[model samples]
Target: MDQYVEILHWNTQHGRKLDAAIAWLRKRAKAAGRMPAALMLNELQPGQGEHVGGELGLLHYPAPVDDGLDPADSRRRNLNAIFIDPDGPLVPDPEWVANWTGPWMPPATLPVNLRNPDGTLSSRQLYLACEHACYWHPGYRETTARFYTVLGKDGRLVHVDGDFNAWTVGRAPLTLANVADRAFAQNRSVLCGTALVADDIADRLMTAGGFVYVHGHAAEYLGIEGADAPTTDHGPDKERQLIPEEDQPERGLSAIDRTYTTAELIPAVIDANVITDPDVDALADHKPRYTRYGYPDLVAITNLPVELVHH
Candidate 1:
């Protein structure tokens, strides 16, 4: 089945102002008999009560409002109240395929294409290209202003930081395919896992899920170490060290190739695992696990594509 997300309003006001807007939309939505399915706010994490939105600073969608945790919680609001038949009117007619012929379609073919009643060829490639230019465009600042209410949660856009303590060797491999697959296979239930446990992977997954990635620290693209970079080793005297690209084991490629910032990475999600340069092998060989040790909700089994998930 195909899904649609409606941003009810996109107000730019941050903090309490955004909260008030959300409250207003919920009341109207309820009155209109359109219950929300999932919310895609600009804040980063889920939380309880109004304060949670205030706390996150609105860089990304705040965490889902837990009904059990706060039945009265209004923050976890959704706007995609209208559901359409995945095969008809909503999708273009040219994209529709008969059931017998649909199976032969490529994985990249969209569900909408298989059943669109509009008859226009809804090219998946075109969809992605448009989406990239619109949502993931270079230096695009996402906001809930046009689609959702502008309650008080507004702040800076959040990004997931890939730079962990270099000595944090015990960390698991990162991928979005693993988490999305599990979420889909497991019936979209929230899998229990800590923020620190598969931290890098989860951040990426959340971004795929349409939330802002809030990497608290700065990230260098391509894993290149800049001058006066801090040593990632453990123990005392682990001071900042200037290292060459070839000599820096932590960095896998040339500094010129370095462009791995969240700003760059989110849009280039498809390229995350592809071995463009011959030198980088770690990402090429790694197959992400569902639950490494105790961590659950690992996203990728192998380097899988996570760009533009259709949940």
Candidate 2:
């Protein structure tokens, strides 16, 4: 039967956000109508094991070594979630205890394709993915996003960055959603259609959520465009004018174009049917946030790049 999966994503590194995370999850459950039948907690440890043993109850023959201790404790550092069930023990997947984290798709759960009404949060599973191995890496960021995206099934996934230490995810999901999710899918009773935790390079952390909004940090594609656009990580894709092959350009000196700034971006969103580069408007805030966090970033956007596309 198609059920609902309420997600609560939070970084367990500093682990101080435990209380807040729990509250958010409880709210998610309340909105979903019923608590999850099973919870899938990612990045438990040891090759990101899919472990089922968490703060909540269980079914069938339980597994050993329940690291449900308060990960908030410095010595324990075991970030776990609360699993609740009264019927019987929620049998752990064979691989559940094979490692630290439990199987992403609980034993009886199916993969989320999000192709129909049955695809979305219908899994009735609570998935809590937290922290990288031990350090912070872009690989972790991308994979975590991808995994959550899968859980979201076609863009139904809701990415909540418990912590944005290295500026993990922000306005990035907006584009991903456009590509993976439905136009304006609202499944859960609570929360928006989607939410991507965001932040800027200069500032701390800010929450980013919404259908067209994806946030981790604009740093990946923020200011510093122009002739130098191609020098950044996303340079190859940044909006830029390519020098024709006929123009036999200089050796080391290559071709170039400019990115779009919010000033020239949002107005375009108001009228245009398609945006070649939506990244610019994804983080578009009416009140530019020079500080890097908060709703001010919705429009103000202290720093807007040039030549972004949305379509």
Candidate 3:
């Protein structure tokens, strides 16, 4: 079947990485003899005022068709849309973009109440709202954001000097209503702390439905006694650790698990991986996670029957 993919909100730095990904996909499609009809790359232009708009000029690439097949055949033209952002700075606010002139309009809007204490929308809030909107939007088959350690100039993982804000919402089946409720509730349920545990311990906690945010001095903060706590042995020294482990007692063990609201967990994961990664200041110069969008709610959407696309 023909697929439609749209990539939204990518900057110059992301362009090179995206190009490599697309090339790999195209090569694979050719091997399978199921190449797509067309691919589109939509860049984010500076929006008017505080909002941002997609660049009008789309970098479109048409697939090379077979010799005998007609290019206009409907069966030959499936659509696949992919949205790529190394760091998700732009929130897809449809209401704000309705009047704007562009081929791509944001698929959703931010809820009225998800604002900061000063009655303004924070970047994190805006991204969360967009994620909430995508969850329920019929047009999107699925969505996700992935978090990874940021690299430093010395060709190593960057270290976070300050406290790691392990922000967390609740578990999955997250909907717009509950997300808004959590965001606006006077005494909303969320988990925010700076605790780091042993990698094995973190893995165990995640297995139980919880998440752990680790960073510089995480070993000392969590009192990890093992040697694995301070090295880059299991991949990059993870800036943060997020597990699915639920809030519960340590039982016979010394570690403890805490459950979080969906609102708290989603942004917490994003903050650790994307919004506040160690290289936030030098994002353009560092290598970001290959797949930059993920959260439990979004992960749920991914398991559904949607066309998979990424950068």
lDDT of 3 by residue, 200-221 (tens): 2222332233223332112234
Q: What TM-score quantifies how close candidate 1 is to the native fold?
A: 0.19
The residue ranges of model 1 lying beyond 4 angstroms of the native Cα positions read 1-40, 44-69, 72-119, 123-198, 203-311
- Positional deviation of 232 in candidate 1, in angstroms? 22
Better of 1 and 2 by lDDT: 2
Error of model 3, residue 134, in angstroms: 11
lDDT of 3: 0.23
Candidate 2 versus the native: TM-score?
Answer: 0.27
Off by over 4 Å in 3: 1-16, 37-239, 244-311
List ranges where model 2 is wrong by over 4 Å: 1-3, 12-33, 37-92, 95-97, 100-311
Of candidates 2 and 1, the better by TM-score: 2
Cα lDDT, model 1, residue 176: 23
Provide the clash count, candidate 2: 56
Better structure of 2 and 3 per lDDT: 2
* Count of backbone clashes, every candidate in sequence: 51, 56, 43
